[model samples]
Target: MDIAVTLEGLGQGFIYVVIGILFIWLVKKIDDWRTRDFDDDVHIDDGNIAVGLRRSGLYLGVAIALSGALGGSSKGFFLDLSHLLIDGFIITLFMFSSRFINDFIMLGNINNDQECVKSFVQPDGRKVVGNTAVGMVEAGMYVATGFILNGSISGSGGTFVQSIVSAILFFILGQLALLIVGFLYELITPFNVKNEIKSNNLAAGIGLGGILIALGIILMSSISGPFTGWANDLTSFGIYAVYGILMLLIFRIVIDKLLLPTTDIATEVKEDRNVAALIVVVSAINAVAIIIAFSM
Candidate 1:
């Protein structure tokens, strides 16, 4: 075994374990407080916001640690890690920032009491997003990091300048896909109506779905021909990434919308059954889609 690789793996694994524990703990804390503060309603306090950041940090750390552990030297770790961390931070920032601004601006027409800011759900069944602006921001970190890392935007071989260019191209293409989906979701929002609460679950779902699908599509698009010549490989990888993101986002939605308020704080609820089933079906469809895409 390569001693350097072994040591690096050990270090990364240690960091991952630490980050995972912190992540679970922070999520639990956020869930507990969210249950108490915004259980039936959605107005989360600023303190809950701090808990959100903790969760985000946990995710960022975990992603970097895991990425590092996967047969890479420490030389590129900081650069790759920084890219992962900053990208995660930026995504989270934009997600929550968009929510806050949208909510605040629409406050007059739509009752400010509706609590739109805190309705974001992190992957691990946490209600941090629905309690405070911070929760969404925190959750956004995870989503952003997940997208950037899973999209094949890192560790490509090139000179410093070339690598920088590749990274930017990767990020820009992903964001461009996101923009297209965002616009599409916004346009389709009028078609899906659930309640008088001014919240559109279908639209939200579509937006989340768009992110995953677009990420897959754009990653494949970015890898075509001379760009990377790895279109086939990335598409195969993207099949999994898209499925994972969808499953994660679906859980996030369920926690934010369904299970949390309905469950009693006295008892613990594991995965929501309906949401789990939905994820299974969606994942299956994504898998099938991937097979078909590759076959053609």
Candidate 2:
């Protein structure tokens, strides 16, 4: 048995675990700072689902970013840690940009941050504080950004300039793709996605969020691997993106029909507000995305 190799693996695992804990702590601090207008600690301790969802998304996105930076090369443990710290921090910032983009650009009609924290009253006069729908959208953005940022940090070859440029370019392109896909997703759905989400429909939120994260997973490979010049990479990335979008959209309809049969996905999401139906959509979409990402 290669005891030295095993020992090294164990040591690396231990270090990574420590780093993960630190990153989680950092995520919490960021959350507290972001929600400074409101007492996040109080809301969270009061069992606010909205706060929980937001925090979970941040944690999940950061974890994904860490994994991406973790990929490629073994330039010793210290070097790896440095790479992760630098790339991971940058990616974290990039992922958080989703909030601005979602609020002002993507879903301009919705104020996700405000909605998440505000309190409301249900029709039956029962008081509802947290808007889990906004939380779901935020969660999806975080996770999707994580996957896209993962692609940005991954790959090999190229000088430092080329790498930076590539990362920046891909990040821009990735956001654009997401914006377009999000628009198309809205078009394809029978119901008004934005309106539903605005009304705090958890089902619609999960439905839309599911597709965004799935697209992010599919696109990760388009920007991954060693740089082989801008033209080649751009063309490849563009082609792969188109394919991913078309296939994923098709899968959304086909899979929902095949699995649910009698149930209309549109009704389940828009009218019935069936979170379970959307969960099925998310699971199936992710399974297909993983397959397509690998096959590509």
- Best-performing candidate as measured by lDDT: 2
Model 2 pairs whose backbones collide: none
TM-score of 2: 0.93
Give the number of the best model, judged by TM-score.
2
Per-residue alpha-carbon lDDT of candidate 1 for residues 142-208, written as tens digits (9 for 90 to 100): 3443444343334444443543454445544444444443344334334321121233222233223
Q: How many angstroms is residue 245 displaced in model 2 relative to the true structure, after the best TM-score fit?
A: 1.0
Lowest lDDT block of 10, candidate 2: 120-129
TM-score of each: 0.43, 0.93
Tell me which residue pairs clash in candidate 1.
44-131, 118-129, 118-130, 119-130
Superposed by TM-score, candidate 1 places the C-alpha of residue 200 at a distance from the truth, in angstroms, of: 5.6
For each candidate, the alpha-carbon lDDT, in order, equals 0.39, 0.81
Clashes of 2: 0
lDDT at 277, model 2: 82
Candidate 2 per-residue lDDT, tens place, 150-248, comes to: 887787787645766776788788888888888999989888888888877888888878888888898897788988888999999999999999999
